[model samples]
Target: MSDAASRLAEVETNIAEAARRAGRKAGDVCLIAVSKTHDADAIRPLIAAGQRHFGENRVQEAAAKWPALRGEAPDVTLHLIGQLQSNKAEEAVALFDAIHSVDRSSLVQALAKACDKLGKRPQLFVQVNIGDEEQKGGCAVADLAALLAEAKAAGLAIDGLMAIPPADVEPAPYFALLDELAERHGLPLRSMGMSGDYEKAVMLGATHVRVGTALFGARD
Candidate 1:
């Protein structure tokens, strides 16, 4: 098998094992192969390997490659996993099947407007600044309820909560915290973990794990 396909299979195995550890079925967890900064050539192999869900960090970058890639694999689902600027909401809505970073009220409003104008509503995840890190793009933990309320009031459907724990630290607590928050708010999905920590995240009830490096190797 090709290297990329081999890597994809291993990651799937890991995800299945982790899901089993968590007493959950593997099919219940969505493995989102984060394809940010990679071109179509890099992504096609995984698609051929049956990886239907992928993620990108920017709307323009995703637009540059995914249109053609999806043309080849119409079953592929694209997710916007990076922080989104309000002005890019229209383009992001048009391009991605799901968005994992709806973190603030203004962006929520912009997305609502875009969805209304375009007549398409992608699955939305309200990001929580679970670590309260200033450099991050998520809404403050204290602000989460308010932000989610604003999103609902704007007529946007919030599918779940997404978060990145403070880097270089043990992520279990943060993953557990995100799980608690999701349960508290009755959200069914939790988008947490990257390649480094996805197993822990799945064990902690993550419905979606944004895996990149493990599937694609280190970025250039």
Candidate 2:
């Protein structure tokens, strides 16, 4: 097998093992290959491997790469998994099938306005700072109730909650908290976990997992 194919196989094996250990079916967790900082050349092989969902961190970077990959992977689903600024909300709405970092009311309002003007409402997920870290981009856990209320009132379809636990912390508890919050708000998608902790996330009921390095090898 080629280098990319070998990496893909290794990732699949890891995911399957994680799922097995968690006592969950392997298909229950959707793998969102995070292609951030990588070019289309790196992504195309994964696309050919039947990976349909991908995530990117920057609007400008995705804007440049997506069009070039469009012809080769027309049916791929793209997700914007970074902090989306208000000025870029319109483009984000147009570019991604879901925005997984809607952390503030102002950003929600901007996205709503953009969707209203464009007549397209993409799926949204509120990012909760489960670790309560001061430096993170997500909203405080205490603020989630109000944020959920605001998102509901704004007519945004909140699929579920997303979170990044403290890098040094175990992810299971934080993933559980996000699952609980999503249940409280009647949302269905729990987009927690990354390459390192996705199996634990699946056991806790994560509908989606953003995995990059585990699949593509470490980024520079």
Candidate 3:
């Protein structure tokens, strides 16, 4: 196998083992190969190796990179895994298949309008500031319910919840908290975890793990 394919395989194996330990099927967890910053040359091998879901952090970056790549590999599902600006909602709605960072009502309104105008509704995930971090782009835990209600009122369907725990800490508690919040709010998917702690996240009920470095190697 190519190096990228080998790395992808290892991460998949690790996800499977983590799922088994949690008594969940590996198929239940979607591994999103985060392709942000990496060029098409860096991503093609993983797609060739059967990776269908990928995550990108910026709409502009993805817009520049993915169209041609998708023309070649039409089955790939792109995910927006970063904070989105209200003004860019239309482009984002038209580009991504799933958006993992819907965190506010203004964004909700923008996305709803964009979807209506474009006649397309991508799967949405309400991001939570689970760690209560100030610098992150997520709805405060206290405000999540209201945001969800507002999104629903705006005609946007939210499929899941997403979060990033505080850096340099044990993420288990935060992952568990996100899972519990998802359950309480009737959200079925939980997008949590990244390269370093994805296994822990899988065991803690992460339905989707955004893995980049582990699969693509260190970025430049």
Please provide TM-scores, in order, for all candidate models, with all chains considered together.
Answer: 0.98, 0.94, 0.99
Candidate 3 per-residue lDDT, tens place, 92-194, comes to 9999999999998899999999999999999999999999888899999999999999998999999999999999999999999999999999999999999
Clashes of each: 0, 0, 0
Residue-by-residue lDDT tens digits, candidate 2, 40-131: 88998888877888999999999999987976788988999999898999999988888999999899899989999899888889999889
Q: Which parts of model 3 are misplaced by more than 4 Å?
A: none
RMSD of 1: 0.7
Query: Which residue pairs clash in candidate 2?
Result: none
- Model 2: how far is 61 from its true place, Å? 0.7
- Name the best candidate (by TM-score): 3
Error of 1 at 186 (Å): 0.7
Instruction: List runs of model 1 lying over 4 Å from the truth.
Output: none
Quality of model 2 by C-alpha lDDT: 0.87
TM-score of 3: 0.99
lDDT of 1 by residue, 83-199 (tens): 999999999999999999999888999999999999999999998989988899998888989988898898999999999999899999999999999999999999999999999
